[model samples]
Target: MPKRLIAGNWKMNGLKAAVSEAETVAKSLSEQSADCDVLICPPATLIAVFEEKLTGTAVQYGGQDCHTNESGAHTGDISAEMLADLGCAFGIVGHSERRTDHGETNDEVKAKAYALTRANVLPIICIGETQSERESGNTLKVLTEQVENSVPTDLDGTKMVVAYEPVWAIGTGLVPELSDIEEAHNHIRATLTNMGIANADEIRLLYGGSVKPGNAGEILTVSNVNGALVGGASLKAADFLGIIRA
Candidate 1:
C-alpha cells in the first residue's frame, strides 16, 4: 500500500499568526514517529510563509487553489507555475467550494489539474455528490462522471490524490456511515483504474467531510480510505494533531 497522506485544508482562514500551528504540528510530530505524509493547504497568502517555517520538517504546505494559465491578464488568479516557484509540492483543484462558489465545471477542474501536473505539483482532486444526489441514490453515478471529467486522461496516479467529500456533510458535522464511505472510495478507486491512469493502484483515496479526531481512525481504516482531507478540525494545532495521531 502507498504511504497514507493527511492533508489539512484551512480554507479561507489563517494569517501570519497561524504559522505557530504549523510549528506546533511539526514539533509534535518530531517528538514521535508518524508513518504518513502530512500536508497543510492554507489560503494562498500563507503558502510562501509556511513554506519557510515548515522547511526541514515532516509537514509540507500547498495552495488551496491555482489557475490554469501560466500567466495572463486574469487578475486575482494564482497560477500553478507561481505555486511551484513558491516551493509548493501540492495544489488543490476542483474543491467542492470552488465548484459551488466559482461555478467551476469539471472541464475547468481538469484543466487546472493538468496545469498543476505540468508544474510537477501533485493535484488533490475533489469529487463528491450533493445531498439531493445521495438522497436520489445516484452517489456512484455522480462520482463516476466527476472522476471521468475532472481527472485528466494522462494523469500520473502515483502523484495524485482523490478526495470524496459528501457535500452535505462538509462542515455540517455529519458523516456517512462506514459502509457508505467504503462504497464511495472503492468506486473512486475502480473508476480511476478504468480510466487507465498510470500507477492506478498507487493512487491515494481520501475521505473528507466532518472528519474529526473522534472519527479519524475509523474513517482511515475503511477500505480504499488512504487518509483524510480534513477541514474545520485542521485549523487548530491540537485538533489537527488529534486527527493526525489517529
Candidate 2:
C-alpha cells in the first residue's frame, strides 16, 4: 500500500499570523513519528513563508492552484513553474470552488495538471458530484467524466493525487456514509485502470468535505480512503493535529 497522505487546504483563509498554526503542526510532528505523509496547501501568499518556516519539518507545502502556462501575460494567475520555484511540492486543480466560481472546464484542469507535471510538481486533482447529482444517482457517472477529462492521459499514477469532494458536503458539515465513500473511491480506482493507467492502484485517493478530528479516524479507515483533503479543520493546529493523529 502507498503511504497515506493527509493534506490541509487553507482556501482563501490564513494571513501572516496563520503561519504559526502550521509551525505548531510541524513542531508537533517533529516530536513524534508520523505514519503518513503530511501536506499543507495554504493560500499562494503563504507558500513562500511556509517554505521558510517548514524547511526542516516533515510537512510539505503546496499551492491551492496554478495556471497552465509556464510564463504568460495572464493577470492574477500563478504558473506551475513559479509555484515550483517557490518550493511547492504539489498543486491542486479542478477544485469544485474553482469550477463553480471561475467556470473552469475539465480541459483547463487537465492543462494545469500537465503543466504541474512539467514543473515536477504533483497535482492533486479534485472531482465529485453535487447534492442533486448524488440524489439523482449520477455520482459514479459524474466521477467517471471528471476523471476522464480532468486528469492528464500521460500522467503517472504515483505522480498525482485525486481528491473526491462532494459539492454538498464541503464546509457543510455533511459526510457521505462510509460505504458510499468506499464505493466512490473504488469506482475512481477502476476508472483509472480502465483509462489504461498501468499503475492505477498506486494513485492516492483522498476524501474531502467537512473532515474533522471527531470523524477523521472512521473516515480514514474506510477502504480506498488513502487520506484526507482537509478544509476548515486544518486551519487550527490542534484540529489538524487531531486529524493527523487519527
Candidate 3:
C-alpha cells in the first residue's frame, strides 16, 4: 500500500493561540518517523500561521477550500493560486459543507481541482452520500457519481487525494461498520480505475466523519482506508496524535 496520509480538516476552528496545538503536534511527530504522512488543514485565516509552525517538521498544512478561478472579483473567495502563495501544499474542494451552503456542483468542483493542480497544489476532493441516500441503499451510486463528475478529467493522480466522508456520520459521532467502510472504499477505488485516472490505485483514499483515537486504529486498518480527514478530534494535539499514531 502507498504511504497513508492523515490530514486534519480543522474546518472553521482554530485561532492564533491554536497555533500552539499545531506546534505540539509537529514537535511530537518530528521526534519519531512513521510510515504515513501527516497534514493539518486549518481555517484559511490560520494557514499562514500554521505555515510558520509546521515548517521544518513532518506535518504539512493545507487549505479548507479554494475557488475555481485563478484570481478574480469573486468577493470573499480564495483562489488556489493565493493558497499556494501562502505556502499551502494541498487544497480541499467539494467538501459537504461547501456543497450544501454554496450549492456547489460537481462541475464547479472539477474546475477548482484543475485550478489547484495548475497552481502546484494537490486537491483533496471530498465526496459522500447523504443520510437519505445511504438509508435508501444508494451510497455507492452517490459516491460513484460524485467521483466521476467532481474529479478533474485531466487530473494528475500524484496531486490528488480522495476523502470519503459519509454525510450522515460527520460530527454525529457515528461511523459505518468496518465492512461497510471497506466496501465503500473498494468501490471508490474501482470507480477511479474505471474512470481511467492515472495511477488510480496509487491515489490515497481517506475516511472521514467523527474519527476519534478510540476507533481510529480499526478504521485505518480497513481495506483501502489509507488515512482520515479528521474533524473535532483534530483540535487537540493529543487526540490528533493518537489517531496519527494509530
Report the lDDT tens digits of candidate 3 across residue range 91-161.
99999999999999999899888988989999999999999999999999999999999987567576799
lDDT (0 to 1) per candidate: 0.93, 0.94, 0.91
State the lDDT at 139 in candidate 2.
Answer: 99
| Candidate achieving the largest lDDT | 2
Which is the better candidate, 1 or 3, if ranked by TM-score?
1
Clashes of each: 0, 0, 0
**Model 3 spans > 4 angstroms off:** none
Runs of candidate 2 exceeding 4 Å displacement: none
Find the number of clashing residue pairs for candidate 2: 0
Per-residue lDDT over 97-160 for candidate 1, one digit per residue giving the tens place of the 0 to 100 score: 9999999999999999999999999999999999999999999999999999998878778878
lDDT of 2 by residue, 21-78 (tens): 9999999999986899999999988898998999879899999899988897999999
Task: Please report, as a residue range, the 10-residue window in candidate 3 with the lowest summed lDDT.
Answer: 151-160
Superior by lDDT: candidate 1 or candidate 3? 1
Ranked by TM-score from best down, the candidates are 2, 1, 3
C-alpha RMSD in Å of predicted model 3 compared with the true structure: 0.9
User: What's the TM for model 1?
Assistant: 0.98
